[model samples]
Target: MQKSLHITPDKCTGCLQCEMACSYENYQVFNTSLSRIKVFDFHHTGKKVPYTCTQCDEAWCLHACPVEAITMDKTNGVKVVSEDTCVGCKVCTIACPFGTVNYVQETGKVQKCDLCGGDPACATACPTGAITFIDSNWTGLDKMKQWAEKLSNQAHA
Candidate 1:
């Protein structure tokens, strides 16, 4: 049973603990800039939303890499970028529709959330229960789509 990160933006409080944990886990530092997960602050609305790679099934970033640096881990369905093979061309960054794939200036290689090898640090560090690792079937994306469809129907009524 594959698990996925289920994110609920409404529960986030902008504390940025997720970012700190992520950076620490991946880079051995506590720098938000180095973290793969980002908390977006909506200034006008005073809301915070934590965002990261969803690890899409299509994985446009993986497909766009010229050197095939990114490969899907079949066991867990995570798209992992091989830094040794990556050329830092930034094509994967461009191909990523969600802007999750990023170029790390220090390493000159691209980076994205690899689910922390299926134990996501960001999810574990989320204090408000905003992020949870759960079964892929219950990721909440399907519910969001249904809600959007309902709104669309109401709009057309």
Candidate 2:
């Protein structure tokens, strides 16, 4: 089954453990800038939202890559960028609607979330359970449940 990380922004505490873990796993460093996952801090709303590649079914990155560096891993449904195959082209970065795919000058290649080879370090490091590895088919389950609860409350009222 395909796996995905569900991030509940409301539960996030802005500790940045997820960013640190992602960077450490991929680069062996604690630099948030190097991390594929980024946490956006909304100071006005006092909120933090951890954002990363959504692993789109029809990934623009995969198609935009001229050298075929980006390909979909059928097993996990992740769009993985092969550094060796990449020609340092920034086409994929521009194709991504969410801007999750980014260019790395140090490596002269692009990077995005690879689901950590099916074991996401960011999800494991999240202290508040804001990030959870779950079945991709059920990604909308939480939102469905939340709406169901709200409907029930309205019925009672």
Candidate 3:
């Protein structure tokens, strides 16, 4: 049963707690820039969407790595980058269409979300339940359930 991070952008408050938690868990620091998860703020619409690696089934980053630095974690279906193997070529960064994979200047390597070893800190740190760690097979279950409830209410009315 693989799990995944489900993000509800509408529930996010742009608090940046997820970034702080992710950085602290991975790098032992509270730097948002160091965090793998990034919150994109749309000033015009006043919307903030927390974005990270989706761990694609056919990951382009994993395929683009010349050194084979990126590999899939079978346990959680996450694409993990090995810093030791990474040559900082930035090929994976370009291959990823989502632009989730980023090059870290300090380490001279690419970094992205690895689901924090199957227990995502960003999801846990989210105060408003905007980020949730859930079963990958049913990521849309919540939305479906919500719509079902609404329909049920309409039927009752």
Q: How accurate locally, in lDDT, is each candidate?
A: 0.94, 0.93, 0.95
Worst 10 residues of 3 by lDDT: 134-143
Tens digit of lDDT per residue, candidate 1, span 35-124? 999999999999999999998988999989999999999999999999999999999999999999999999999999999998999999
Clashing residue pairs in candidate 3 are none
Instruction: Arrange candidates, best lDDT first.
Output: 3, 1, 2
Cα distance off (Å), candidate 3, residue 134 = 0.2
User: How close is every model to the real structure, measured as TM-score?
Assistant: 0.88, 0.93, 0.92
For model 2, the superposed segments whose C-alpha errors exceed 4 Å read 139-146
Tens digits of per-residue lDDT for model 2, 34-115: 9989999999999999999999988998999999999888788999999989988899999999999999999899999999
lDDT of 2: 0.93
**Which TM-score value belongs to model 2?**
0.93
Clashing pairs in 2: none
RMSD of 3: 1.9
Model 3 lDDT tens row, 1-157: 9988999999999999999999999999999999999999999999999999999998999999999999987777889999999999999999999999999999999999999988899999999999999888984777899999999999999
